[model samples]
Each structure stands twice: as C-alpha cells, then as structure tokens.
Target: MAHIPAHSDPARQGAPTTSSRYELLTLGDELLLGLTANAHLTWIGAQLGRRGVQLQRNVTVTDEADAIAAQFRESWARADVVITTGGLGPTCDDRTREVLAAVLGQKLVFDPRTEEAIRARFAKFQRVPTANNLKQAYRFERGEVLPNANGTAPGLWVEQEGKLLIMLPGPPNELQPMFTEQVIPRLAARGKLSDQEAYIQIRSIGIGESALETMFECTFSRSPGLGIAFCAHQGQVDCRISSPDGRYGMEKLRAIASECAALLGDNLLCFGHDSIAQVVADQLKQQGRTLAVAEASTGGMLANAFADLCGACKFFQGGIVSTSNEAKMLMLECPECLLKQHGAVSPECAVAMASGVAEKLGADYGLAITGFSGPCTGGGENPLGSIYIGLHSPHGDWAKQLTYPGPRAAVKQRAINDAIDWLRREVLKETHRIAAPQVN
Candidate 1:
C-alpha cells in the first residue's frame, strides 16, 4: 500500500494563508476519443474557483487500468486533493474500482447501506435490483460513501497519509449534488487554502487579443500572485483573473476592471459571466420592448438562442427564415427589384429584410442577418465569410458590414455575436453608436 498523509492542519482561523493544491482526472474512452464535449471540466473548475480552490492540472485518460492507476499516483504526489470522474459504472470497462483496490492494497467490500440506498432507488421505479447492481454497493476499504439521490451510483471519498481522493460519478446530475452535499463540507474543513482566492470573468466584444494583452502589459507583469488568461471566440474575448487574497483581490479586480471598462468603452459588452444572449434579453426585459428576426445565412440560430431563455415567448414575437429570394419578396415584402439589384448578401438586402420583418410581425424591433458563410456558392463573386447584419427599430434602420475570415460554422457564430452586440448598444444607448446603412 502506498501511504499518503491526511490533512495535517484541519483547524485554522481568520482566513490565514495555507496552500492547497488540486488536480482533476477524468477517466473514460469517450473523453479521450473526443466523442462528447467534456462538460464536467468547466463546471468543476468554476465551482471550485468560487470556493477559492484553483485546479492546477486537468488530465484525461482512457478506461485502461494501468493508465488510471499511474495518473492517480502522479496526481497524488503533486496535489493535496485529486478528483476523478467516470469509470464507476456497472459496465465491464469500469476499471476505477479494481485499480483503487490494487493500488491501495485493499479489497472492495459490499457496504449494506449503499445496497439499501440502491434498492430504495429501484423501488421508486417499480423494479427489483438485479444481481449486477450489487457491484455498485461496494466501497473501498475504510472509505466514506457519497450518497447520490439522483442515481444508483454512490461516490467514494478516501484519505491516506493526509491527502484526499474523491471519486465521483461522471454524470453531472449525480456528481453535482453529491459534491455539493458531501464533498464541499469536507473540503472547506481542510483549512489548506493559502489565501482566499477570488476569480472574475470580464467578457468583451470588438477587442482583439493582441490589443487586450498590450493594454495589460504592466498589470500582469507586476502582480505575482495574480493570474490572468484570455479566451477569444465568436467575436468576443473573455478575460479571466485570479487573485490570492479575497479582500485585496476583489479591490484589485474592481480597480483593474474600471480601467478596462474605460479603455474598451463601447467595445466592452459586460463584466462577469453573462452570455451575449442573456445580456440582450436582460436589456430588452428592462426596457419592456419586443423583437423579431429574419435570418438567411445564419438559419434560425438567432431564434433558437432566444427560445433557450425563460419568458422568451412573450417578447421574442416571431421570426422567419427567408432563405430564398422569393420568400424574402413575398413573406417579408421586400421589393423583387431590390433583390435583383443588390443580391441576397448585400447590405441593402439586409436592411430590406429587417424593415419588412418588423412590419410583418408588428414588432418594436427587427433584426436580419445575411451572408456567404462558406466558400463561394454557385460561382458568385461575393467573398466567402462576408456578413451583413441589419436592425430596424423605432429610431431608424441600421446595418453593419464585416468580413470575417473563418470556416462556415465560425462565421455564423461571429455574425450572431455581432448582432447581439448591436442590440446591447441600442438598449444601453451609451458608448459608440452603429450608424444607419445607406438605402438606395
């Protein structure tokens, strides 16, 4: 048995600094093969960050016994706490259970309480527990059980030589509640956290990565305990900051955020974790306004985004996918001659679409997106990834033309993000204003 020490300093007071390290290990062939998005990593990272725990490394391995055991040993050596997800199911490839037994020099013993919980869960579904289900009742020797109210799998928490190893089920519903209920209390009691860490995400649009990095040159260079990272996608940059001490960190975050807000000006969409769609919906809700959309190049993605939110049906009004010029002319009331003159991907066409949809749907505002998202289609001279977005509101009709160089899916996302930014500016009515497009 490899010996590891348990938490040495469980009792500390007044948020005095104590260093605590963390590592995440995900076990599943599906994760290694990239069959499904690793949703757990982001959720776990955010959850721990809120509690001042910084996960240093995230490792993913297939369901191979040797590979799993090796990662376990390496992670335990480096970090005080290690969290593993997946490989706990009843299937044959579930290797976490046996590997833990081998590495810890212990045997898996059936725990009757776990069996009772599993049986009770099955009873609710009007089914009997099969013999195979008993495998879930087994726990590592001297391990504590994490009851899962949502599922049959019970999580395991173990400690040796002072280090903590928590094995959680892969499914979010099971893992989330268990961690919240059983794991958080134990972790908070560790008293291993060095300084109370503070994390904040500042989301902005219309700023390039190089520009943001250059602006923060001295800021990042000087702060030793402060960590900073930037993620750019769909025409926005997410600026993340981590500070060691909570009070001092929050003060620094506020000052730096104020400077960023001033520098980015209208380009800054929001501070914190709000999505562009959510921001737009919040503004619309505040103003008690409504919206409708007409999409061609982007399909109905704009509509779908609004639909994802609650109370959308009340304010979203409706939308039309006028893919063909005939629908644009007949359904949206755009003049046929305009389609012939400017083509579907032109700013003039976008304006017409927006203006027509707003009138057709009897909405306060209308948005239209048109573009060539991919390589030239049907031998047209229009450049690929050229997008034009139009907005018609009580004030006036406006359009913005941007040439984004990316693949098909990326172009559509950029268009949607830009459109959302336009909405944000209109609702706020401060900062830089998008000029109305010229109508022929």
Candidate 2:
C-alpha cells in the first residue's frame, strides 16, 4: 500500500537519476490528426520498462519538418535518450531522417551499403526498388545504421553531445524486432539500463479497480519500497505489485504476493499474463474434463475464447452459435416451452441451452450465453446490454443475469468475459473440492 509516485510527478522524475531517462517522439500526420493511434508509446514503454529504462515523456508531431525538428530538440535536451518512430517510409511525407539529421547538427549522407541492401531486399521479392524507396538509404553523418530485417527502411542510431537518438520505422512489425535486437543490446552494452525490478501481477474479474484499491488499502499494511498499480480492462483488472527499490529482494515481493493471493481468493483469475481462458483450459485438463458452449448474441466469441488456446481440442468439445430460436431448439435441443414463456434472453432459456449442449456433446461442462447486446432490445422487459450466462457442471446447473452498459461490441466482449470467468470459478471450486481429503 505504499504510495507510488505518478509518472508525471516532478519528484519521481528527479528521483530516477540512476535510471536512464528516455523520451519518445512519434512522427506522422496520421497520429497528430487522430487518423492513427500512437501505439508505439505503449509498446515501446512496455519494452523499456521491462528492461528498467524509464520512458519519461512522449510527444507526437505532424509530418511537418519544422515541428519534428523542434520537438526532437526539446526532447533531446531533456532526456538522455530520444526515440522516434514513423516518417521513415518511402513517401515524401516521411521526413524523420532529414529532420533529425538537421536537428542533431549532422548532414544526411547516402550510404552505398544501405542502397545495396535495399535493392537486394527488393530483388529477393522479385521486385525493383523505386526512386523514393532509395531515400531510406540515407544516413546521418557519424551515425550507425540498424538494419531492418522486416522492411525497406533501415533504422538509425545517432549520438551527439553524449545524448543518444534512435530512429525506427513506423510499422510495428519492423520497429519491434529492430528495437529488441538492435536498440536494447546497444543500450545494455553502454551501461544505460538499470536492474530489472521485481513485480507480480494478479489479474482479477468481478471487481472494480476502485474497490480493489480500497480493499488492498484496508487489509494490507503500507510497506516501504512497495508500489502498486492497477490497469482496468473491460471486465477485468490487473493489479501489479512491485518492489521498485533495488535493495529489496524477491523474498519480500513473493511474501506480499502470497498475502495478496490469499486476500483476493476467488476473485483472482490468474497470475502474470495468463488469460482466463488459458486458466480454464488448464483446470479442465487437470480434471480430465471437456466443455461445450452455446452462444446467442455473443456469436462464436465465447467459443473462440477457449478454442484459441493451444491443445484446446483435448478439453474443448465444440460450440454452437444459436442465433435464432429455431436454431436453439433444433441444434441445442432447447425446449420450445422455455423459449416461448421466458423469452430467448432469459435465464431459463440460457440454462436450457447450457444443459442441452452438455447433453448433446456429452461433455463434462456446458457454458452458454444469450444476451441483448445492441442498439436495439426486446421492447418491454429485456433492454439493451441485458445478458444471461448459463453454466452446467457435473455438480450443478445455474444461470445469472448481468447488465453491461456499452455499445454492441463492448457488451458482447463483457458478456463473453463474464461467462468465461463464471466457468473458470465453477471449475476451480470443483477442482478444489476434488483435491480435498474426504471426511468419511
């Protein structure tokens, strides 16, 4: 529960003197005009953070050369490292290389090696390089070239007056690998990276970020050098507990993680980056059980969630998307009486669908979802965002009604998450009970 300083806080900025402070400058009119999201910020920040490098500030500028130069100058003066993405393509609007060269007080020099590499790459694809594509062969004087294995534009690594500037391509496919292979190793060799921090992430469902924060504050004592951060998705929250202080060892962090796991108990989905579906798949495999799913409004999303996991065929039986009442009755063997009386989106119909699918597929468990995720809803009783999740396990069969306020896609995703979490919790309980010693 220790207070963690925000990234923008001047105090935190001043305190990270040992860690190399990096700033990102994203170029492109698409980003500035909101035509494209600046995804580089998140990806680069995460990569750097994992390596214990602090990415301080991010600035986005249009394709204008002056604006790019101005932002680069400002970022270079403030941060020890400045990384730019975009504007490295073959088009005339791609102005990152020239602008950065001018700002860094270096001339743009064409390298025959780079032009040969580009032409070779084009020849490999049975194509010829265009005149503008050769523009990517230009390098800043006294700068080292970072070869791009994925694209035509080779990245640049330049240093002027002790500050480093790394320019990468805009496409994620090209930028990510180059940064990982080229940028990180160079930084590490130069002793510019800090020691990796110790951290644990606990993903949870059926809990709001605020509520989790309050619970942690009330139950857990504030310990020195411990920091907590929460990231909330549509239906889940990831709680990250870190020991940012280099002096603290993993033992303390593990102890705190254990306490947190015990506190969260049923609400906790899984640790680290494991998805809920993956956890459920593991549980089913451990229990030697199989599952089938029936979906109405969520289409095949609920089924895809499980089927997407590796080796899912061992535990995932099959899925049916029963969009129509007739399909529900014919395919899932849902009773006509239940659908007629309580409507298709009701708990009764949902439960019937679950039971029918389990019986039809001869699986150990059945999960079903019928929802009104839409801009339109059934007139009187059932409104938009109304959802019913049904689960049929070897132990019991039940259904729950949930309401999520959002657009169609958001509502569908939330409903799918809820259904998956419900199934996960039920399977978890069954597994625990089976593992427990019998009380004769």
Candidate 3:
C-alpha cells in the first residue's frame, strides 16, 4: 500500500505554495457515537479528488466550541483551505459560528437576510420561529453567505488569516449542491491549474493481497508518475492505480493495468470498478439470460448482491431465501426426503435448492448457497466455515465446496462472494463450450 499522495510528496519544495489543498473537519456529537453518518467529508473528498485539490487530513469533533476551535486551528495550520459541516444550526449545542469568530478575531453579527429566510421557512411549515432560531443569521467578518437550496441554514464562506474557511449544513441535500455550485468553482479559481492525477481501480477476487503485490512490485516501482494501492478483504481485492498525467489519463492507465492483470492470468477477475455481482450481471446481459437465487446459510446476501446491481431488473428474476428447513421444503419445494437424508448443509441439498429455484422461477440459471456459516457443526463433525455453492443449468446441477477461515460474518460474506465467482466462471465456461467446434 502507498501513503496518501498529498501527504507523501510536497507540491513545491521549501517555498510556501499557493493555497491549493484542503482539510475537512466534520462537526457533530453523533459521529462520535457512530449514530450520525459523516457523508459530507467523503462526498467532498471524492469531488475534490476528481479535481486537482487534495484533502490532507480529516477531523471529527462534537459541537463543543473549544474542541471545534482547537481542531479548526490545527487543520488550517496544515492546510490552505478548511471545510466543515454540521453545527451550523440554531440549537444551543450549535457553536460553529462562535468558534469561527474566535479563530478569525471577529464577532458574529446578526444578518437581516438570514433572519428573514429563517422566519419564512418556519412560516411555510405553519410554525413560529423561536428565539434560538435567530442565531441562524449570525455571520463572521467579510464572510459570504452561500444559499441552501434545501434548508434554512445557509452555508458560510470566509477567507481570513491567510486561510479559507467554509461551513455548510449537515444535511446532504443542502451540503452537496451548495458545495458543488458555490465552493468548488471558488476553490478552483483560488488554486493553481495543475494537471489532475488519474485514478483506475481493478477489482479482483480469489487472489490474496501478497500474491497480487508480488505480481506487480517490479512494474509499479519502475512506472513513473503512477501510484498503486492494494486493498484486500476476506473475499476480494482492489488494485488502485493513480497516475499524475491529465492527457490520455485513465484511458492510458487502464490499458497498462489490464496488461498487468493479464500477466496474473485467471486470478484477475473483473476490470474497472465492477464488483463480482456487477460482473456476473454483465455476463447475464451479454448472454441474454436471467438468473434467480436460492440462499440458505448465506441468508439473502447472495440474492441481495445481484439486486443491488444497477439495472438488475433487466436480467435478475428475483430469488428465495430458504433460511429454515421448513422454508426450503415449502417455499423452494426442496425434497423433504433429500433434506432428511443428506442434511441441509450437504452439496446434494445445495444442488436441489438451485435446481428447484431455477425450475420454479423459470430462469435460465439459478445459484444457491448452503452450509454451516458459524460455530455450528456440519457433516461428519466438520467445523465452522464449511460452505457449499451450487449452480443449476438446463444441462445439469453442480455444487462446489468451500472452507473459508474467518469469523461468522466473514465466513458468510466470503461464501457469498465465492458463490458469485463460481457462477461467473460457469457462465464463461458454458459459453465457450457452446461456441467450440463439435467433432462429430
């Protein structure tokens, strides 16, 4: 893995570089409790990444004035621009205005424009504005008020003490549009017009991080102006390539990455940003086939993965989650005799589940996942992480056994990915076999 690009290399050596990069500070007590999500920072960072600006550091603080001021000071000291979301409301806990005033040696004065807007909003809701709501109009020295399309609380943009500060409301509906329309263009104008780095990610499965790293160690080390990163999980790996060449950019980078992946052979799964489910969905589209799923131990995850794919309704015929033996027999029409004899975790049971789903749904193919995804025992005292995935086609039904090593949730997730990968491979193989010459 490579370090964050902005932090590793200084834009210019020694001299003070012009205002270019930014630091994001998200303020809310909910973030600390893991209740309120911090989506603004991620959204802004992604947007900035598309441009040339880089977000150096991110800090999350409660609505406390002291904590917000301390973080604001620290962030601005390192970054030329600072962006904050949350704590802009008129509630007693909202202290963003006071903190910004303290940091910039200014006082918050009531603005008539903000006050009228707040009052109008409350009137539309058939309510009277409270005294606390008057704080919404507070503004700092020479600060510009950015309109909020979706909310009453306006965003603030201030430049002082050789640093740029921007504050927006917490709600995504307000934050996203305001940041795009009001903040981004201003930042671009203030910063230098440097060529942006291109980013490309190659998603793969059934390959370990160490092996993937070794496969490209030499190539990445020698590749000029390219940054490569590998993110590994239980069932998947992502190879991220970022190059600092604006011209021919991602196109050129993707071509090189495809060549590197080809070197790794079949270990390379999907190209670009497609997940395993997305890749499988693409295969179904190409073959003009629809798929249905029968999930057991993996719950509905296998089916849910396909449903989450974009335009899934085009080829996914839905699925059934036979969580219990009764559901399997009743809903999916799995043979009660087979379940009693072979057990639900057995490959035979998985085969029946897949075939039953395919026949019932009238889909071209069906995928089923069954096994012990827990601390429970399976056939012949087989320990946890024992899983079976079956694929049923018009020709026949076949199942594959997988033994993954991880926690209960990890095991289930791994099984789901493995099941999808198996179906993907089968689709490729079946297509190739059908296209092959028959030696009659």
Candidate 4:
C-alpha cells in the first residue's frame, strides 16, 4: 500500500486558517463521453466554498478499473482530501470500490451490517436482493461505512496515514444529503474546514457582461485584496466579490457591495442567491397581491419560473398558455377584433390578454407575453424574435416591445426574463411609493 501522510502544521491549532485542498474524481462513462453533465463538480465546489474551502481540481474518468485506480492515486497524492462520486452501484461497470481496494492493498471485507441495511431497504420495496447486490455490502478492510438512508449503496470513508478518501453514490438525491450530513461533519471535526474567505453575490438583469465589467473596472482599479467575477446567464448576470484574506473582513466587502449596488441601480435584482422570480413573489406577498399570467410564444415558462419557488401559491394565482388566437379569445377573453387587426404578436393583443386574464382570474396583477420566437416571421411587418410584454396592475396598464436575436428556445428564455424583470420593477415602484413619507 502506498501511504501518504495528511498535510499538517505542528504550529497550528483548532481550525487552521489555511484552506484545505479538495480534489474531486467523478467516475462514469457518461460524463467522460459527454452524455451526462458533470454537475457534481459545480455542486461540490459551491458547497465547499460555503465552508471556506475550495475544490482545487475535478477529474472525470470512464468506468475503467485501471483508469479509476490511477486517478485515485494521483488525486490522493496531491490533495489533503479526495472525494469520488459514481461507479458505486451493483452493476458490472461499477469499479470504484474494487479498484480503490486493490490500489490501497486492502481486502474487500463483507460487512453483515451493511448487508442487513441493504436487505431492509429492498424489503421496503417488497423486493428480494439479487446476488449481484451483495457487491454493495463489501467494505474496505480498515475503513468505516457511511450509511445511505436513501439507497442500498452505502458510501465509504477510508483513511491511511493522514490522507482521506470519501466515496459517494452518483444519484444527486443520494449524493447531496450524504455529502451534507456525513462528509461535512467528519471534515469539520478533523479541523479541516475554515472560514477564511468572504463572498458576496449580486444578481442583476437587463445588463450585458461587458458593460458591467467596464463599469466596475474604473471604480475598483486600485482596490487591493478585492476580486470581482461575473457569471452571465440567459438574461441575468451574477457579480461575485470576494476577499480571500480574513483580514479584509465583511465591513470592507459590504462597503464595496454598496458601491456596486449604487452602480447597478434598478438593474440590480437582489443580493445572494434569490432569483428574479423569488424577488417578485416576495414583493407581491408583502403587498398582499396575487398574479395571473397569460403567455403566448413563451408558453408557460414564465409561470413555471414563479411556480418553482417555495410558497408560490400565495401570490401566483394561475397561468394560461394561450398559444393560439382562439385559445386567447376563449380562455383569457382577449378581444377578437384586437387579434385580427394587430395579429397575435402585437402590443395591442398583449395588453388585451393581460387585462382579460387579470379580470377572469380576479388577480391583483396580470402579465402577458406575445412574441414571434421563430425561424419564420409573423408574415408581415413583424420580424422574427419580436416580443411584446404587457402588464395590467391596479395602478394601470403598460406594454413594452423587445427584439432579441437568437433561436426559438433562446428567444423564449429571454422573453421570460424580460417579463419577470418588468414585474419586479413595477412591484418595487409600488413598494417604494407605499414606504415614502408624506410631505404634508
């Protein structure tokens, strides 16, 4: 067995200030072949970042025994902690366990406790365990088993000398909970975790990445120990500001955040991980208002965005996917004359649909989307990717037209984001008005 000592400092005590280097090895033919995304890398990286540790590298390999063993040895030699996901099932392609055991010169010991747990889990489904299922019950000769409440494949935790290896199942549901509950606590208890970095995320809409970068560059050009990164999505951008050194503190980060917020202005959605839909929902709930949506070219995606949030039922009354002209006229009571005169993709139709749905559903706010997200145009003056968003609120009715250049799916996503941002701004206006002091 190749023994590698864990990295340690004799002069340090109680949670060291230095961050632990974590390397992740994801094993699956699907990932290496690009048939499946390596979501584990992103998710694990984020979790470790929250704990003030950074994932240094992530290597994805096929389900080959030699390849798996080689990568494990390489990662173990480099990182203080190494974690692997996938290839832990009962199938023939599952090679992580046997490969790692051979590499570590440890025997594969059959654990009766693990077998019993696996049997109990199978019994719950009223199914008998197959012979091959016993493969999961085997553990390392000198290691502890990490129980999996959600699956039959129990995880493994093995250590030699000072280095550690943690193996988890591939299914996200199984992996997420085990990593959170079992892996994190073990690492923390060993004084491997630290809170030495400060991070803040600011989400914004209706802004280009280059524009945001240019705006922030001149202001913070001389600021030392400050780092800014931008992640752009379909219609949103996330600005992450970090100070890796603990000496900077959150006060400096907050002060910098306030400056960024001032520059963002109305373009800023909110801080942290709150999405635009969540922010809109929060505002509506605060105002005791309900919203109904009528979507055309965007289908029901706008509604799905809101419905995905927790407690959406409180503010999201309902939504209608009025794709065809007849459906709009029948379900939302959109004026037939408006559709005929202005066509389905028009500001007139959008406004009518918004007002109609709000009246039909008895909601405080109504949002409508009418667009031509197409390879073909609307067969008139209207070109492809023309979107009209309409809003009918207690205050009044309003509409705006936007042109996006992209494929059908891209246009639809952009339109959905535009509608969400529009509603967010309108709700903010109302919130500000209500909070404003009287001048009497």
lDDT of each: 0.79, 0.84, 0.79, 0.84
Reference-based lDDT, residue 303, model 3: 88
**Model 1 misplacement above 4 A:** 1-18, 116-130, 177-182, 189-197, 218-227, 241-249, 310-315, 326-337, 360-362, 375-381, 430-440
Best to worst by TM-score, what's the order?
Answer: 4, 2, 1, 3
Error of 1 at 35 (Å): 2.0
True-structure RMSD, every candidate? 7.7, 5.1, 5.7, 6.5
lDDT of 4 by residue, 1-440 (tens): 00111223332221215466789999999997889899999999888766657788999998999899889889888898999999889999999999998988999999999999999999999999999998999999999899999998999999886888899999999999999999989998998775433366777788999899887886667567666789999788988876654445555566666787789888888876677788889889989999999998987898899888899999998899989999998999888888888888888888998999899989999999998998667657668989999999989999899998979999998898888889888888898889899899
Clashes of each: 11, 0, 0, 1
What are the TM-scores, per candidate, against the unseen true structure?
Answer: 0.82, 0.86, 0.80, 0.90
Q: Give the poorly placed runs of model 2, Cα more than 4 Å off.
A: 1-18, 120-126, 193-195, 218-222, 243-247, 307-314, 329-331, 335-338, 356-363
Model 3, poorest ten-residue lDDT window? 1-10
Best by TM-score: 4
Window of ten residues with lowest summed lDDT in model 4: 1-10
RMSD of 2: 5.1
Clashing pairs in 2: none
Output the number of the lDDT-best candidate.
Answer: 4
Report how far residue 232 has shifted in candidate 4, in Å.
Answer: 1.8
The C-alpha stretches of model 3 lying farther than 4 A from their native spots are 1-19, 33-43, 106-134, 137-141, 144-154, 159-163, 171-197, 221-225, 244-252, 375-382, 430-440
Q: What C-alpha lDDT does candidate 4 achieve relative to the native structure?
A: 0.84
- As for candidate 3, its clashing pairs are none
